[model samples]
Target: MGPTGDGGGDGAGLVVIIVLAAAAVVSLLVAFGYYCYIRNKVSKHLNKLKRNNEALEKARSAVEEEEEGEVGPTVVTERGVQVFGFKQLHSATGGFAKANVVGNGSFGSVYRGVLPEGRKVAVKLMDRAGKQGDEEFKMEVELLTRLRCPHLLGLVGYCSDNGHRLLVYEYMANGGLQEHLYPDGGSCGGVSKLDWETRMRIALEAAKGLEYLHEHVNPPVIHRDFKSSNILLDRNFHAKVSDFGLAKLGSDKAGGHVSTRVLGTQGYVAPE
Candidate 1:
């Protein structure tokens, strides 16, 4: 009877140990599942944060590019004129399509374009084999950078990359004064005859532009190529002097004049 009682007790003890082991395995499995669920949740949250950060960075870059009108990094001339990339200007001008051309000159052609910031602009693309060489291009950039007046055409930027030279200006919706004075084969057409009052206003504005360049600014500028075509008008018929490719920097010395070979439009050249 004693041995039987001992055996029964041992059997009961073995059953309790087996049950406890099984319960521990189940508890471990539950804990592991809960850990896996938490890990997956944390991973998803991290991925979402990463995506949001990437999107924000892209937005910031676009804003910067539009504001600066530069690629890779900001490049400004000595006079605070922005420098643009060749690709940027090319894209803006729609690959310099014939349909986008607004004007053609001895040096190159001008195209109307919309910038990335949605601002209308005029791009003057210099011809590779034009008479205007690198010196003229550089002179225009330098002179335009220093000359800033309401009556003068505003220089938006310039591009000089891989032998591609171009100048960017604020778009003049009314086109050039030549178009209004002589409408045949001009850029802006659907316009009626200019009234006496309107003509006088345009003349006065043009005079103001010249006065600003000749008197107001120190070391006056000489618009060597002043002509009807060089005088651009805005949407409100406000005259703004354009085209400084042949501009010469005047001397500040009393009675001093820049002596150079005469170069201007045939009919517009001054007989000095």
Candidate 2:
């Protein structure tokens, strides 16, 4: 009887050992599955963050370019038609190089660039973010395409690409009237003397240009931001109005007096 009892006790101990071994194997499989799940989740989250960062960087670059007055390729004249190539303008302006900047205004920066054809031109760069700029670019193209007058600033051409808007014009040798009137590091009290005859001629010539904009065109144009700075002169001192960013066409058809948020240089702005 004692021998039979010992054998049964040994058999029971063996069964218990097998049960524990099976439980250990099950635990290991469960742990491995959980680890895989966590690893996949972490990988997915990291990828998402990377994509978001790239998008944010692109947005920041666009804003910075606009604020700093940096623009992309400008348009220019090719024969009688307005034309521009991404590669050509890029090379001409030294990749819109910062060193080429000659002037700046409310609209954008002016770069003095030499074309592939060896023509010197003034490139006016505009901000792509603002609706005001977009409207100005469209209006200039449409209005200039239709009108032809010597007193007005000639639009050689324009470029609309890569979120950049630019206007190209024949470079003025003498620069704008404001530059002559208000030389840097000089007191305004001693502004450059404009003789009576010269001033009178300028007034008349500009008046005729305004008359053309107001009376002759199918839809009258109003130069909202008229100032000495906008009055550019060539080598012969011939006056032609520049900076049409605030110019509007068809003032007659505009709704309810069309009030604009105040624009132009402080001293040059017209009183409402």
Which candidate should be chosen as best, given TM-score against the real structure? 1
Give the per-residue lDDT of model 1 (tens digit) for 5-104. 9999999999999999999999999999999999999999999999999999998987777565465324574667667777788788898889999999
Q: 178, model 2: CA deviation in Å?
A: 0.9
Best by lDDT: 1
* Candidate 1 segments exceeding 4 Å error: 1-78, 128-132, 185-192
Least accurate 10 contiguous residues by lDDT in model 2? 72-81
- Per-candidate Cα lDDT values, in order, are 0.85, 0.75
Candidate 2 displacement at residue 95 in angstroms: 2.9
Candidate 2 deviant stretches above 4 angstroms: 1-80, 185-193, 251-262
After aligning candidate 1 to the native by TM-score, how far in Å is the CA of 210 from where it should be?
0.9
Model 2 clash pairs are none
